[model samples]
Target chain A: MAQPNPHNTYLPGYKEVGHHEWRTAENSAPYLLPTLQSLAETNPSLTLLDVGAGSGTITTSLAKYIPQGHITAIDLSPDILSRAASHAASVNATNITFQPASVYELAQTFGPAAFDVVHAHQVLCHLDAPVQALAQMLAVVKPGGVVAVREIDMRVWSFHPFSETMRAWVEVQKATHAAAGGSNEAGPSLVAWAMRAGARREDVKASMGTWLYATEEERRVWGTSFRDRIVGGEMRKKALELGIATEAELDRMGEEWQRWMETEDACCGTLHGEILIRKPK
Target chain B: MAQPNPHNTYLPGYKEVGHHEWRTAENSAPYLLPTLQSLAETNPSLTLLDVGAGSGTITTSLAKYIPQGHITAIDLSPDILSRAASHAASVNATNITFQPASVYELAQTFGPAAFDVVHAHQVLCHLDAPVQALAQMLAVVKPGGVVAVREIDMRVWSFHPFSETMRAWVEVQKATHAAAGGSNEAGPSLVAWAMRAGARREDVKASMGTWLYATEEERRVWGTSFRDRIVGGEMRKKALELGIATEAELDRMGEEWQRWMETEDACCGTLHGEILIRKPK
Candidate 1:
């Protein structure tokens, strides 16, 4: 049996969540590409640090932006890190390296003022000490280096025509996230977190972007992925164990999701807040 | 001299802002159309109560959605309402009727349960009593009717590459909005407001969407519009009179905005939250 993560309430199910996240990360290019391109504009050969690089999806995609640059990708899960390494190797992305590490230990391991750009996507929301981790990230970046973070504000996740099942699902998801010490408001709170982490308010720039799953194929993939996660994955198990939802409720939600996916005009929007802060030189 | 609206801080300059808003509303179809379509899905013949129908841009567009139904469009400003009526007449949209009314007086004017849909775009944020107005909207909406509201959370309005002038422009805009008794955080607070207005939590459905100005024409139009608003319009006068920004600062911001807009990859994202609350049958 795996040990329960004191900080993470969704343990024994993170691996499955991590797998789903890999797919989610892959489809996030629309949101991530622009930020990456912005960072690469000034220095194509920049050194990059990727925090919580699950399954190396974003990391590998990021590799294309900096052909001459090197990437250090870190995650806390050794299993996931190994899987990331294998994926990178299969892709012939030799410029990237995967290592098992925690956000808490970043500054200690990398020393101060280490990288040209530090980036994290959907990482801080899951951590117990997001501010401290952000501080660590800021500490390790060289002066004038950029620290970019992207996160979701799940409170804004809503659907129209008013489905009770979808609402219940959202509530359960939020509860599960909270139980795991995650911040559902992380996206909108990025700048405040950065400022709290000691970055100057004037240095932080915040913008909003979205990932819309509107096409048939996109909706199917998105809906089915959540369906599977809820039915057979750790989310189902944890949700039940935590008493956040009943098995019947989850099942009904799964059906509602499927029905929603089948509706011709059905679309989903995921809102993300992007913050880029440059350390004063 | 115009009476200073206790609830609105931008009274003296509202005419100019309202004119600018007309132009803005003309371009808002991409954001408002889908929501209207969704509400009209089951009921093609929708009797729509359009609150704050400035310039009749959205009201006329909405006429196409409910060809068989009628629209009651209202606004407080007689000048803008006249403009809206002229526009509606020019468009030959016979389904919409323009009137001067306040949100607080909706229920009294229309009586209980008069319309199938009560819709407002970017209106509630400008109200002194958003929740009370919401209650009035709810009162006049028939049972099982839908109340759709869209508002912006200006906090998410941002620009990249860190321009001090741009920041100042945003602050001035924010202050001007505050002076007008507008809620900069209204978009994210929709659901809460609905609940406070006595709607059941489950009856309210909230979703977020964005408008992006990234294409050359889009950037040019967006940039130039703001540039004009800042340099020559009443926003310029109010921003200076209120001491939110200096004339020189506004000039520099105008230049910086033009420069930002001209950048090849420059993109602007305007985040909006849409809520649909169904009256209990």
Candidate 2:
């Protein structure tokens, strides 16, 4: 069994929430493509199994990318599915087939080994039984097929300017993770997160998580402070060149090592980091 | 001198705008309060001066903390100043003095060395000549007094799960910055941002910047991927302890990222962060 992660719990009304529009250019190409691309490479005719596909953003992108693929996406929200249906239509993607269902009960409705690629982004982190869900997804992927997932690790945030307010905010996050009975691991520690998610060490390196930082300073600070160290100096320098964050913010952040470290736990000095992983057969 | 950040070039029809209620608890305190707080420590009376105080969120917080100190706040927007006046009255903070005035021409109105602590939040970053404005703030503050300023980096943002239609809404920030010929450090790089207003080093460390990830995954990913070092066993663990984004929307963010990165050179990336700086002793 994976060790308990105190941070991935849930609070009734305090889930980390955001819209679909915030994804950046760097994140889209890899997480959203590989599975579909691999499937397309092997098939003359394709049917997609889009799990927890919200608002058909992926389905829409699929239409734009591989217009020939037939899509069947499943979700529990009619409010979302209805919009996904509309979005699919708006994008002029007619081959999509969406169902109002949960991954828990999805296989019951559809036959096993039905899709060329069973895919999702940031989904398993929310489920109570992720391993079982993975099993379900595996059952649905034909032998030699692919299962793709994208996740964000919150443990990567290393540069929060300290304050009483940030302290309170971190507390709220801790409470949410505790509430979830420890099944979630998306916050800053993506490597450990991958291990907990059942990924092997080799896979972690193969699919490095791509994080989005606001400024060069943040990226630099994060690069120096986060564990994965997958990106830092060059990435931060590029962001500076690209105008992400200021050198001053990055410098001040370096001086700020004390505040995030004030916790009596002795380990407060380090914050979060994120990583992306994939399974290759 | 710096090729007026491409993001700062002006657009044809856009106008200045600010959010009284930023969706997340942006913790703008780092960018504005550090300078003011440092100043407060030296001058026991903590008498305060608020330039372009707008609706006086700081004025109220100051009054709450320094009940014995006198407070004077000014703003050019009579409409906004009226609200400050009413709120001061409602709070029974008679020690605060409000004036209707413009920051562009402060010397003609408020006397020199009028305050021990001068402050403004989310104000200077929007002006035409921020340097002149910072100098004006210096003029109002006593030689040994502190002058503080805060602003939203306005750059680092993942609007998704917050507002989907404008998920790449940070483009709006770049557009606004480019139009002004100012540095694009308005968002996630607020720490470095204060320097644009001409803040010095001692004035900066006390003043900091903050980044709020929407979920535990974000925090963890940041820590492990970017914040950690080559010598590591996950330096420290940062758990999702909170939910900041949903599984479905976050999963679909990759597609949004792709579209978000496709802006004119003037617009790109999510920009958001805050900075607080103190005037010199």
Candidate 3:
């Protein structure tokens, strides 16, 4: 539903099929963990709704912080949510419910005020109607609840010891973003969209963070895995179906990742931020 | 800097600047809020450290959720971190301690096991030595502490109702990724890089998510912003300086974003995911 690439890590069996999860916990912490902590502080008995909850990584964490809180997780793919359920079991987590649902159909599936916290992690950048999705989330959360979001603002990016290789590569990153209907400026947009939709400024908050990888091995190998296994696989299939790209485009997608593996150098990636809002009390 | 162009939200006397924070809060919540809930269930009292705590998006969240937990927020840019500190102050949050430091110098600045949780979102993709950044994070977290990451997996992308304009635009996208030492498949390698670097699979947890913009307006308007402002900007500046892309090639980037915008149809953009791992206890 998100992308045509079912083979991506965003799908399933990504790790088993030689896929990588980008930078691991070490590289991801500064931006992700603190934001998670900030989000958890909203309500003591928070009831959370995770739209597009893939593989249950965050679901398990929600169970840890809000032991008694209610959690309802949804995804368009049951195949993926099933794995998430398994993850919950692996972590011995309870108090969380999993379901298969699309963003467009969420209003019909969930009742009003069904959750104290309506959360979607890195979700909007992949949707056809991210703002509409946010609207739907607004509809689902209780009036007094909080709605939180996280996005990678690729627009605020910079580099060091830059090269032509880096420049060309960033273009690919933007292409990736364009095809997804995501703005490299998506993180900053959250605030304006919220206000336009009626949320006030005082109740809103936004922050920025990034993951910086230090090696070409980490960049290319992991980059290829992220592409073919997690994303490029899906894009290739989709473009082929759409006839937007020739066989060559698809092949190049595969080759680029390989080329990265063979090359030597490092990369830096920065995550812009997650903008969070508490529903009006 | 996480992005080459951050919409200049920091411009002096920029009232529209608040719009940045507002929109991020609005749009991001449809996803951001849920991720925090999921993270809460997983050892939320994390001795959290926020790297590049720009505007305090993640750092502030930590203060609210893990009120008793201590946070050492680090950033290299005084301007951005100052904004982060201000946001923390506005909320009267005290649990967070903001520091001016660089990810490259993290290990040298902190002692061993200094943190229980380290998280970054969309950061690793921008670094020259992303693995080294991860290594630094590993050096800080207690063995059992979780390190989580999130990034864009650009390969599964597509823009339907395709045209030559969209095709060229996509070409630019791929070029950007290839040049930046990034791969469409970089998302999954995140976990593998850690495992290969002495972390265990069982100790690792990875997940994926995405965002999609539905309307042409959402896709084109916000879409063109990133393409023109950052991706194109960075490439042209670098190309002109490095002599890789001629002035002609540099000019093409703008044409590309414009061409995509002119295409009238619903388009899809990027998909993303997360990789959460734990070092051996």
Model 1: runs farther than 4 Å from truth? A1-42, A90-92, B1-281
Best model per TM-score: 1
Rank by TM-score (best first): 1, 3, 2
For candidate 3, the docking band is incorrect
What's the ranking of the predictions by lDDT, best on top?
A: 1, 3, 2
A137 Cα displacement, candidate 3 (Å): 0.9
Candidate 2's residue-wise lDDT over A180-267, tens digit each? 4333343323333345546554444213233333333433443334211112333234335545446654444334433333321111
Question: Evaluated with DockQ, which candidate comes out highest?
Answer: 1
Residue A236: error of model 3 in Å?
A: 1.6
lDDT string for model 2 (B1-281, tens) is 11122122122211112223232212444344445555556664777777766666667666665667788888766766777788778878778888876665665567677777676765665665666666667677776666666554443342222335334223433453545455444332344344555665445432223344333333333323322211111111111112323333333343343333331111111222333344555
Each candidate's TM vs. the true structure?
0.54, 0.40, 0.46
| Tens digits of lDDT, candidate 1, B27-125 | 453445665677678777778999988877888877877788889999888888898888888889998888887777777788889999898888887
Worst 10 residues of 1 chain A by lDDT: A1-10
> Given candidate 3, what's the lDDT at residue B206?
48
TM-score of 3: 0.46
